[model samples]
Target: MSRYAEYRALAQSLGVDAVALVPGPNFVRLMKQDFHSHERPLLLVIPAAGPVAAIVPNLELSSFAKLGFEGEVFDWMDQSGYAGAFAALARHIPLGSLAVEGQVMRVFVHHALATAFPGLKIVDAEREISGLRLRKTAEEVAALEGAIRISELALAEVLDDVRIGMTETQIEGHLIQAMFRHGASELAFGPIVAAGENSALPHAHARDVPVQPGDALLFDWGARHGGFCADITRTVFVGHASDEAQAVYETVLQANLKGHEVTRAGITAHDVDDAVTGVLEASVFADRIRTKTGHGLGREVHEAPYIMRGNRQLLEPGMVFTNEPGLYCIGGFGVRIEDDMLVTQDGCRSLTTFPKGLRILG
Candidate 1:
């Protein structure tokens, strides 16, 4: 079978004539190359039972040629625009109904296709298309491990340097530099270095506010290496911890541990989240719960098989996801412990090894 067999099968299953791809995780996975998605448009079309085709930018022809793609290339120039190229592709393949990555493709490209192939049917297959990456291969797991190793090293360095009174943004600067120094190709996302009450916000941004004694310092960050991503979050207390802070921290920690204990192949995603969230729901801080248990993690930080209530997707060996359980009290503080988990035959293994026990920092 050709490499396009799976995609063609997916297209046929989705009841679409072809599947269209833009520059994103799915694109990079199949082509083994990355491209910038700017003003220019680049597209690849795979029909259910025929040869594939592409509309390439004139400038990218040389780079696209390296992929050894067995298809017709309809190249277009900047001055002339991509309409002609899309028009040519329309004539070549004559697609009736097509599947597309709704999250990645831009409106301009959709409009261009609609204009070129008038009366064409475009179906948003974001979930079906991205679901292909739900499971990790051995090689992909190695890349994720490399990313997590670099992130953990950087976090350790930042914690050692974190003293009372340092601004949140200052600490963020230390983190970004340390990730590169420890050998990271790129950041998975902007690092979150919220301090004190700011930590109460699940996705808080670092600010100029100085860290104070008896404050919660939260760091949610990761590094991207070898086309894979690592997402880990650790919350530490600066100086002394209040009685309420310690209670909340311990509660969140237990909930995180529960996620590790219940995950395994053959279990449903809902089961894991229910077990993890149950611990928090039974706690005195139950009202403090602000988010779901976690999300699937891989080439993109968030993907399919979301760990939450109402999702019945079964966990399978080789699937990886984040086991993050957090509790937030708006205007007071928050505590969250996140770890990347790989589902195995018997159970799950945590990819994050940084200590989870409560620690007091200077």
Candidate 2:
């Protein structure tokens, strides 16, 4: 069996003539190379039972050559545009119905394909295509561990210097620098460094507001290393915590622990989420629940096998996801504790080791 066998089978299973890949997680996984998907168009087409083919930009030919691709290459120039390449690919493979990544492929590329192959059927196979990466490999898990290590080290360094008067944006600056200093190739996403009531917003952005004595400081950040991503969120108190704040923090902490306790291979994603959310719903702050239990994590921060209600996807060994349970009171404050979880044969293991104990940072 060839390396393309799985994708070929996927194409056949999807009832499409071929599966088209753009420069994204799936493409990178197969090609083992990264290409920027900018104004130029780069496409790889894998038919169900034939040699694969590709449409490469003239400038990327040298880079694309490194892949040792066993197929015909239709290269086009900038001045001439990519229409010719697409046209040539259309003639070579003559695809009738194709599967594409709906979220990754751009509209311009879609138009180019449509124009080149008139009456071509393009099916959005986002779920099926991305689902291939749902279960992580041992190598992928190592890469994610490296990313989480860098992120945790950066967080520890940032927390050591955090004082009561520093602004949220200032703290954010410290975090970015610390991640790179700790050897992060890239940020998984923009770090969230919200303070006080701003932390109440699940996806709050850092501001210039200074940290206050009795305020909650939330940091939701991750680092990307070796093509994998690590997402971890920790909420801390600035100085002294109010009685209400401690209660809320403890409630969210137990809910996060419940997720860990219930996750294992053979369990449904819905079961893990139901067990986690059940704790929160049974709490006095049940009305404060704002988001789902968590999401799948890997090459992309968000992917398949989403951990939430109504999702029946079974949790399997080697699958990685975020066990994040948060409670937010719009104008008051929020408490969220997030951890990267790897599902094992017997149970799940937390990839994030940063302490979850409520600590007073000054």
- Off-target runs (Cα >4 Å) in candidate 1 are none
Model 2: per-residue lDDT, tens digit, 1-362? 68788899999999999999999899999999989969999999999989899999999999999999999999999999988899999999998999999989999999999999999999999999998998899999999999999999999999999988899999999999999999999999999999888999999999998999999999999999999998999999988899999999999999999999999999999999999999999999999999999999999998877999999999999999999999999989988999999999999999999999999886
Model 2 misplaced regions, further than 4 Å: none
**What TM-score goes with each of the models?**
0.99, 0.99
Q: 1-362, model 1: which lDDT tens digit per residue? A: 78788899999999999999999899999999988969999999999988899999999999999999999999999999999999999999998999999999999999999999999999999999998888899999999999999999999999999989899999999999999999989899999999889999999999999999999999999999998888999999999899999999999999999999999999999999999999999999999999999998889988877999999999999899999999999999999999999999999999999999998997
How displaced is residue 346 in candidate 1, in Å?
A: 1.3
Supply every candidate's count of residue pairs whose N, Cα or C atoms clash at under 3 angstroms.
0, 0
How many clashes (backbone atoms < 3 Å, residues ≥3 apart in a chain or on different chains) does model 1 have?
0
Cα error of candidate 1 at position 344, Å: 0.9
Query: Candidate 2: global Cα-lDDT?
Result: 0.94
Q: Lowest summed-lDDT stretch of 10 residues in model 2?
A: 1-10
